[model samples]
Target: MQPAVVAHRGASAHAAEHTLAAYDLAIAQGADALECDVRLTRDGHLVCVHDRRVDRTTNAKGVVSTLSLAELSLLDYGGEIGVLTLDALLGLAADHGVPLFVETKHPVRYGGQVEARLVELLATRGLARPSTKEESPVVVMSFSTLAVRRVRALAPRLPTVLLLTQLWPTLRDGTLPPWADHTGPSVAMLRRDPEYVARAADHGHATYTWTVDDPADVELCAGIGVRWLATNAPAATRATLAR
Candidate 1:
């Protein structure tokens, strides 16, 4: 089977990352999944923004945790795109039938409140848990094992991914952390050790790699049986995988 092509922050290479327009273009480009980074606003709303601070991506300059949803709404993302709420993105996902990989940013001021609010919002949208015998439209991913565990407690059926930048003690044996359904590694890890993907599969974990854009990297992922390729240029990656 062909690996699933996930848009890393919604075709971010072609447009501003995490904006509505970028996500729209990703769906148009035939991305099998949409990847997003989410954080909690001071007012307890979940918004799609990558960094802890809004400085780099928006007109405003401050920590995202310091701003309320109302205050964040006043800023322009990429000069024209408004700040996106998790609700808005979920609506688009439902309308387009695209699966979403929602990465929870860690070490925020809100602590576990971020995961709690996220599970609540997903429940309200009828997505907190997968329908019987079906994969959920949404999967939660995080670098923090605690965060992934929190989601498992809140919604057991929702798949969780443990993101790794490098080989860790937990992964030296090729097993996923307890309660994690999948393993997400950097593309560089696969390059350094192509056997890592196969080892992850041997231990009953599906593997996904992030931020892959180069055609050679795409080929490497395909050859290693990566279940998902998360990339900034989903259209180009999709075409590459089809070859």
Candidate 2:
């Protein structure tokens, strides 16, 4: 089967990253899954923002955690879809029957509270756990091992992804930590070692790659058997893979 096309930050190449407009457009374009980075605000709320600060995505300047959700809402994100929250995003995904890949930003002041809040939020929405890994619509991903483990501990039946930026022999041999159900490698790593896709599969691990926007990379990923293709151009990638 062709790889699932997961939208990274919601068709971010065409619209502001993490904006509702971008996500809506992505789903409309037939993206299979949505990926977002979430950060905890000062009030302990999880907001779907990639950066620690809002300076890049917004006109106003302030650390995301330093500002309250109400304060962030007033800032101009070029127009509508100001500071989208995880709760609102979950609702949108539920409405469309789409899956979400939630990345909890690490090295934050909140520490493990981020994962705790996520677990609580998911549980509140009746999605804390599923009967099986494949049945879960929400997937937790993180670069920090501790963060992913925290998610596993908080919600035993939930699926988690461990994002990899660097490649080593053990991982190249398809050895992943027990806590992670899937492995996320950067597009560069996949290009550097295409064998990793099949290798991961040998160990019963599905490989997901992030931010793949190039056509050649898309072909390479699909050709190498990547299970999930994360990209800023999901619609385009899906069409290319179909061909």
How many clashing residue pairs are found in candidate 1?
0
Model 1 misplaced stretches (Cα beyond 4 Å):
132-134
- TM-scores of all predicted structures: 0.97, 0.98
Error of 1 at 197 (Å): 1.1
Worst 10 residues of 2 by lDDT: 73-82
- lDDT of predicted model 2: 0.90
lDDT of 2 by residue, 2-115 (tens): 889999999888888898999998998899999999999888889998888898889888898889888888887757646899999999999999999999998998999999
Candidate 1 lDDT at 69 equals: 92
List of clashing residue pairs for candidate 1: none
Task: Estimate, for each residue in 26-111, the C-alpha lDDT of model 1 and write its tens digit.
Answer: 99999999999999998899999999999999987999998999999988888555689989999999899988999999989988
Every candidate's CA RMSD: 1.1, 0.9
> What ranges in model 2 sit over 4 Å off?
none
Please list all clashing residue pairs in model 2, or write none if there are none: none
